[model samples]
Target: MKSLPETLPDETNALQKMVLDYQSTVDQLQEKLKWYEEQFCLFQHQRFGASSEKCPDQMELFNEAESILDSLKQDDSDLEETISYQRKKPGRKPLSKHIPREVVRYELPEAERVCECGHALHEAGEDKSEQLEIIPAQIKVIEHVQVKYGCREIGIG
Candidate 1:
């Protein structure tokens, strides 16, 4: 069998130069990838991580929550003592009747009071809602009254 010829000196040098150039390109790409990874980590930390600026009342609220949770850690027997036969749904208290009230009434237009069936509508009912308003030195209640109209002929309201 014939033996292979050795590479010439200039060919060897050219091959070495190509290898060095490829190595430098790979090194630069790897450096860029590492920088991108660091930036991604930093962005994630800034976006989804816990906030650093905290309200002064936050620590107190945390301690209060911890204390309430600790108090709830009771014996099983105590749980039975805390139960009632029926549970009442929580609701807001009715505003005080002693407050001075200012009523603002709203009604439909005269044209709108007529039903589509050519029948005149009558005052069926009124809905009332109260809002509390405070001035510089006085507090008063503003009650809203919206009158509802109903058609009697075809019962379309």
Candidate 2:
């Protein structure tokens, strides 16, 4: 049977230093937390300023700061729990895999026209409207070119 080797004094000293380093990181995190809180308050005040009454940019900043503050608070809590109890709470959920819907715009050529059958025929109208359908995530777009003669006799070949 093999006996386990005991920890040397040097190893113990290194471990103690590592713990102290972690403690310093926790202190720095606390300072950052305070700064973020102050920024959040400032953003809120800007959003509700009397001059504008409601600044959309300021409101967006306020919301972003608030969310970051919440995340920092969760991180701080997790850090404290790690230091004292060596355990952490569950963190934020991963992003969803679903693709988001997007609005796509395309300009039809000036030579396009609408036919009696409700189909937009080429070289018929200046203005055209279409309700584009959303393509699936896996689908790809392809474009094709077509040329037609106004008179069939012009294309006898």
Candidate 3:
């Protein structure tokens, strides 16, 4: 039989091996947990956060248009001669007549319609405004059924 001191060394070596194996397993599990956490966070952000990414090309185009407008304004101001140009007047665009409209007539109260002079105010032209409303798209599943016809006949020959 081996002495106690010799056996002690072998037992110590076995214990050290077990400890190393456990430590390695723990490290691998921790690494996998960290990766799963990162993936979860990314998925959550994609689902709940803003969907649009800013386009660099669009930004560049907008900046270029603004610069062109600024340069035109500067040139107009620097010219000593009076430049008479007809500028398009900005006004409310007329709503398409084809679109169905829900006419809401807002009339003043009967008492308020009469002036202090006791003369009834005549109806002037009404002002009209249009607003575009949108309905969100809906998803639906349609089930299709097909009919099959089968012919059964006995052999005559």
Candidate 4:
């Protein structure tokens, strides 16, 4: 036979080229179908999605859809293969585990005191509770110094 021309000779040659192109495309589609069939077989035997046990119904439906789409795409080579989709779980909040400090109690020692009689007195029962006591944010102190004049009189200050 003579060497094929650089381009199609006529409409018949063009149709032959189209038929060959279609056959090559079909072969490619067949390969893809084989691969997808292997993938689906793997999916059906064990885990379908990331967590098949958790959402078996949903995963089963998804796998079935994928299988059907694969079959359909094999015939219609132009259509794209179906991709798997998954939903992400919401983030969990961390719990606080801190413990609080307990309150403590104690009594103060008796304060020293001097009377007008110029003698020290021992503890009388206990200091009576003062009513209407208000606690400020901070403690305060007041100092008093008295000047005394003496002419050998009773000790007074």
Query: Judged by TM-score, which candidate is best?
Result: 1
Superposition-based RMSD of candidate 1 using all C-alpha atoms, in angstroms? 13.4
Error of 4 at 39 (Å): 0.3
Inter-residue clash pairs, candidate 3 = none
Residues 77-114 of candidate 2: C-alpha lDDT, one tens digit per residue: 85643355556678654333353333343544545544
Give all TM-scores, in the order shown.
Answer: 0.43, 0.26, 0.34, 0.24
- CA RMSD of each candidate after superposition: 13.4, 30.6, 26.6, 29.2
Candidate 3 segments exceeding 4 Å error = 1-10, 48-50, 54-58, 70-157
lDDT of 2 at 55: 59
Off by over 4 Å in 1: 1-91
Worst 10 residues of 4 by lDDT: 125-134
TM-score between candidate 3 and the true structure: 0.34
User: What lDDT tens digits, residue by residue, belong to model 3 across residues 14-75?
Assistant: 87886687789999999999999999999999999656655646667878999999999998
TM-score of 4: 0.24
Which residue pairs collide, candidate 4?
none
Which of candidates 1 and 2 is the stronger one according to lDDT?
A: 1
lDDT per residue for candidate 1 within 1-157, as digits (tens), equals: 2223564245878768867877899999999999999999999989997677577577788799888777777543366564557887897777899999999999998988988888899999999888999998999999999999999998755
The C-alpha local distance difference test score for the whole of candidate 4 amounts to 0.54
| Cα lDDT listed for each candidate | 0.84, 0.56, 0.62, 0.54
